[model samples]
Target: MKIVKRILKIVIALIGLLLLTGIITLWLDSSGTNYLKINKNESQFGNSYLIKNVNIIPMNQDTVLVDKMVYIKEGIIKKIADTIEVNGIQIFNGEDKYLTPGLIDMHVHVWDRYELGLYLSNGVTAVRNLWGMPMHLRIKEDAMADNIFSPAFFTTGPKLTGSEFVGDDNLNLSNPSEAKEKVILYKDRGYDFIKTYYGLDKEIFDAVIEQAKISEIDIVAHPSQKVAFSYHLNPQIKSIEHAEEIVQQPLQFDLDVIKLQPIIDSISQSKHTRYSTTITVFNNIYQMMMDDSILDSESLEFMNPLILKVDSENQFNRWFNAKQEDSTTVSRIKKQHDFHITIVKKLHEAGVTIVCGTDAGIGVTLPGFSIHKELAFYKEAGLSNYEILKTATINASQTHSMMSQLGTVEEGKIANLLLVDENPLVTLSTLKNPICVFVKGRKLNRETLDSFNEKAKNRKNLMASTLRYLENLAIGK
Candidate 1:
């Protein structure tokens, strides 16, 4: 009896040790070390889908499906068919909602801490931040690892620029050599791409492009003063920010710039290069500063309140509509905008892929809701509704090289999807009514995204308001 008691005590102690070890291991794994999140064994709601009932929209033209049920497990679509023969699997009735890939906004900014909440709220599962703060990147890293709730973030880490006014918070590179070094540093630091801001000289831009290509990084450029529009023809530069051809006024200097159209077409044709046109930026800027009446428009509902709350405080105010007083300047800006639209039309005609991007979280471009505005602008610029939708959905996935895992709702794809109350096919603006969003099969409704936003916004607004008050205090009335 004594021996048996001693053995029992030893066994109990060993079991306790094992249990403690397991808990510690799980805690570390869940401590925000990675971006991949998994939500398992949840009941599916919606149409009782069978394999044959799942509709697959392969962004690629080669494969397609219709009316098939898809089986999802471990955060990925396991199979599709008229019927899946798995037992104890939850079925999500996907009949009411067409399963397409989660929308991608290739060009966006998330400087505000609460920006991620807005992105998720809009059913944007993946975003490529052209420029981002280091702190945002860290938070993104944590969010990816399930440490916090956020979108899948990929960014340039910092802007390589010479302008101090680019933003109060930006990594400034004064020279080409510095720019090259910065690109490598960011690449080493796990940045997804290289972003060049305005003011870098041609030499710096070229150097940055060369180094970026060599480092296996995609180079995205904003309209820089020092570089001519012709630079985009270079194969090394992969994508151009804001419509590449529109921002620059037509210059008559003795250079081959007239050939810009052909070069642009060639780059657009290149499988290696992609274009992200943030037309919403142009529309908003023109409306806010040029027309002034856009501020009072009902469309501004899509704008983030936080951005409107802080615009006066951020000094990089590049908001201005060109005054027609100088006929030449106004004509030039108008001509340029027209030229950009023409180029997009030409590019589309030539089969060059275009990615829909909204430069949200910067200046007048609002978060969460700006994407719909971008589509509207795309339509205004000559693209049909189908083309614009493809730009935001399927084409965007291809631009980011995420065709397999993203950009479509199909078997063997991540179950990141959006369910809208209305059909977005008829009206692009209806994409805003997101009933539910799924990131890695973890379904979040409008309420979830809104809840996250409320929590994040309260803290964020407090800080912003405090800063504003301090700035006024510093001015001493």
Candidate 2:
């Protein structure tokens, strides 16, 4: 009896220790001091500035307005004209430079706050994080309050899935009531949207959608394998996540472009439907798993050390071992990836709205860098440079329902703009580096942005790394 009592005490003590550790970790992760907080000074925040003699790609059209001056005051674009004589305004000589709306990555998995600077440095001014945790709410609040030098942030609640869940960030619903209850909980918690995963059943999916409508929130979904694809194509879903979801449908192969006309038409006609093409992410994984030389070239400097460790132990290990045992499986994945690219082209041609999204922070898709690669994939899929840019700018803002305030550089819009050395419409490569980025009217030059990137690359300490590794393990990542 005494032995059993002692064991029970030990178990209770261990549980208490774990609970305390988790609370401390969450506090640290959400603290403003741990992130690159933008000092809210008069010069950087809520200040008036003018960029003189610049070319503007407003992103509302395919044309550029040349030799114009843009005036920003109090985090808003106050005016744009050929010339503006404004007193007490800092002036930037934008001679031969081009200004465009900041890029947005519509789908990302944000694991840590450090990646926020990485995203901003890559010209991504806004992001829609697909997975949400308690820490994310704090991050969102900080971003919205302009306390952090981060992107315009939005996030969905934890992913809703059925059985076969792989991580702790998912709510596994076995019935309609559970789904409805979870939706209400997340809505009350202030999550922006509801993210549905692949294992959900038709009944549970319908319940989630209905509950979300009642809660006045949006639904972002990956078509469930258990449900028919047509079910997910309803106008209720805000965005369809991956291209594979559409490509995996049973369609007769034909050379005629009209073969996919019906599917495309349905998607185009839907009131609340946008597609996020995460092609670069899948392609990155395929290259790393199939080609040894390619894997060696892919750098891990910018990736979170904890993510890398978890991936190396789980996803990477599985792929590498499988490739060594059977090359045929990897070949099949490559073929599937090519098919996904083809489908993306067809969707673009059919006038379906495409939003740029890189499934970054998962495997090898580094946070900020993957969006640029996604744009390149869109180009390879036969989209013009202008069209590809739209997926990241205008279309992305539209997806997030922030078109009025974002997606374009005009008077009365938020001052999330990027100034590049060359014309991005003519050459997409110019967007890979920005001369300066203005977030909410605060200017960060290339040198300052580079410092942010460098800090993230070398920010991992031994204690944090170990804690993160253990956290990922506990969550089954």
Candidate 3:
């Protein structure tokens, strides 16, 4: 009995010590955190503004409205007129710059506040976060309240990974009843959608889809390995992620070009379903495989320290240190990167909706900057610049039913706009550095945007974010 009592005391003391450490870590993380407050710009135009003599690309169509005036009131675009007069609100001289609706990255994995600015700095005004946590909901709430300078944030619940525990971003549920319950719980918790992952078996996948349909929520398909590719072509599935996933899951990593056409035909027939091109994911793999020193590149400094810490298995180190050349190389990984480009081009020709996305949070797809490269690949795939912009703008907005509120620069719409120095239609490179971006009504000008980018480069709040990430794992429970 004495020995038992002594052991119990030791366990209690260890628990207490751990709790104290967590408190200290959170305190340090919140210390000197002035960078989170991003609305430091001198705004004579407080959520209401007038722009004179701007060329509007609108993005509802391929035409441009030259030398127009736009009036915004309380974060809504009141009117876009050839000439307009307004008083009591600030007026910005457009000076003939090209103004368009803000870009929408249809698929992303956002882990921290820093990544929010990365998207905005790159002119991405809205994002659909794929693997979500309770922390994401808090971030969305804060962003809406203007407490955090962020894009229009929407997220799914934790990924429904049945029978497999992959990483920190997973909630494994093999039971069908449990899967249905999670759908309801996520909906009640205010998650915008439910995300399906690779590990889910057919039984669990069916339950999730049925529950999502009954609950009237949306489903975003990431391809389930246990099920065939055609299984994800359900009417309830809104968007399919990653062109490479088509190879990974549906094609089952088969490299036969002969077998590819039939699957492409089936996808082409699913007219209502939208697809996101995250070729950057495979491109990252190819680069890591080929380049000896790419893992230590300077671009990775901007990655969230929490993500860098949590993926402790270290995908970069694994790829770099692999005994074989590079696992993703075509000789080993099957279909070549050029073949992936061909797949994208075929999808475009089939009149499929191709949305712009970069799986930016992981491995070397730099958040703000990498979208341009994805667009360049689309260019190589034979999409005109207008069609490429549409993937990130109007086409993207339609996927989430946000077109009523955003997706265009027209009357009676929320003001999410990006102003750039050059015509994006002529040169897609102009989107890489937007002169200014309007999030809802708040404006982030060049200098303010630069500051946000700089802060994002510095890794902050490592321990605190990791603890929060752990806590978020049990959100549905």
For each candidate, how many residue pairs have backbone atoms clashing (under 3 Å)? Answer: 18, 0, 0
User: Highest lDDT, which number?
Assistant: 3
Cα error, candidate 2, residue 213 (Å) = 1.2
lDDT of 3 by residue, 1-477 (tens): 999999999999999999999989876765434555646354743678898989999988899899999998888999899988887778888899999999888778887777888888889898888877877888888877877668888898888886775665577887999999999999999899999987899989999999999999989988877888888889899888888877776667776667777878888898888888688877877677676676556777778776665452277667656636555443453246777888888889888899988888877677777788888999999999999998988888888774458788889878989999999999899999999999876777888788778877857777788888778765434
User: lDDT ranking from best to worst?
Assistant: 3, 2, 1
* The 10-residue segment with the lowest total lDDT in model 1: 32-41
- TM-scores, in order shown? 0.74, 0.89, 0.92
Q: Supply candidate 2's per-residue lDDT for 356.
A: 93
Cα lDDT tens digits for candidate 1, 60-133:
44334556667767667777676678775555565555455677888886644456667787778878887555
- Candidate models: Cα lDDT each: 0.62, 0.81, 0.82
Candidate 2 lDDT over residue span 175-248, tens digit each: 99989998998888878988998799888888998898888788888778788766777666889988766656
Cα lDDT over the full model 2: 0.81
Off by over 4 Å in 3: 1-21, 27-33, 38-42, 164-168, 310-313, 323-335, 474-477
Model 1: CA > 4 A from native: 1-54, 62-64, 162-170, 174-176, 244-266, 290-339, 402-404, 421-427, 449-477
